[model samples]
Target: MKLPVLYTFRRCPYAMRARISMYYSKISYEHREILLKERPKKLYQLSPKGTVPVLNLPDGKVIDESLDIMKWSVSVNDPDSWYVNNIDHQLEIISINDKEFKKWLDRYKYHDRYPEYSVEYYRGKCEKILDNFEKILDSEKFLFSNNISLSDIALLPFVRQFSNVDIIWFRNRFINLSGWMDELIGMDIFQAMMKKFEIWNPFGKGEEVIFNN
Candidate 1:
């Protein structure tokens, strides 16, 4: 069978979430690790936006958005019920993470790039979203319930990025959120999702890497 092709950058949170979802769903695919500086011509051809975590289906359909990739993976096979409950609410939380929280997170992570605000100001903006997550997590193990769901997988990478900006600060506050992060980060699927691969060569003899195999 011709597996789906995934173009990914290791440290990109968007790619990370896509990998996490694929790994969790046990959907095997062709892993094509790419460098942002030297992106393959085919990647741009496949996705005009030229973003990482682009999924090229065997049938020629392409999924460029990371969240869409996650949704697609779960749609194929959701053994753990990742997409089974509270879908509307889950999408709402994911929207906050993607649209609102991501803006503040980018500013916070690269505070030097955005000189209009202090680092603390950016962090403060991020904390408002984190505080909401903490409140939800305080009552349950995962975002929506004790069991992990689509929202948890969708939001984990971004929250992990936010925590890494200043881990000590993150650990000092948000006890529930920190524990939740730790649990997800330590999972076998997460660890597998993070394994590094050689950069893919679109023109040369680059061996195919099977993700979630």
Candidate 2:
């Protein structure tokens, strides 16, 4: 079978989630690392919106959204049944993480770009997301259950970006959330997914990074 090709950017939270899901599902593919400023022409042609984490399937289908790519990869081999139960809840939280939380996260991370608000204001907004995660972790080790699920894997990358915005401030804000972040980021899956790759050059054959469990 022809392996799918995945275009990714290492530090992007969305791309991180896609790589984690593909790794967890043991989906082998040719990983192409791209730069936001110097994206490959094929990537733009395939996904006009031109976001990273785009998956070009062997069947010629293209999945441009990170969530869709996660579902596609997990469906291939879900030993943990990551998507079978609590799907509605999973989607609900993931949506909030992607939409509302991400809005505040960007503002907080790049306060200079969105100068309308103070850093504290944006930080406060994102803290609500951390509050929600802390409440969930108070009862369970992972979101949705004791074991890792779609919610845990899907949400962690964004939370990681939020945490890195001001590590000292973040660590002080939510103890439970901080512990949870430490645990998830320390996992083998996270480590493997975050391995560095050279920037892709469409003019030449770039090395492929495989995301196999």
TM-score of each: 0.95, 0.95
Q: What local lDDT does model 2 show for residue 73?
A: 81
Leading candidate by lDDT:
1
lDDT of each: 0.90, 0.87
* Residue pairs whose backbone atoms clash in candidate 2: none
lDDT by residue for model 1 (94-194), tens: 99998999999999999999999899999999999889989988789998899999899888899989999889989998899899999999999899889
Report the lDDT tens digits of candidate 2 across residue range 35-138: 99888889999999998889999899999999999999888989888888899999999999998999999899899999898999999998877798889889
Model 1 backbone overlap count = 0
Q: In candidate 1, how many Å is residue 97 off?
A: 0.7
Off by over 4 Å in 1: 205-213
For model 1, the local distance difference test gives 0.90
Candidate 2 RMSD to the correct structure: 1.5
Q: Residue 157 in candidate 2 has what lDDT?
A: 88
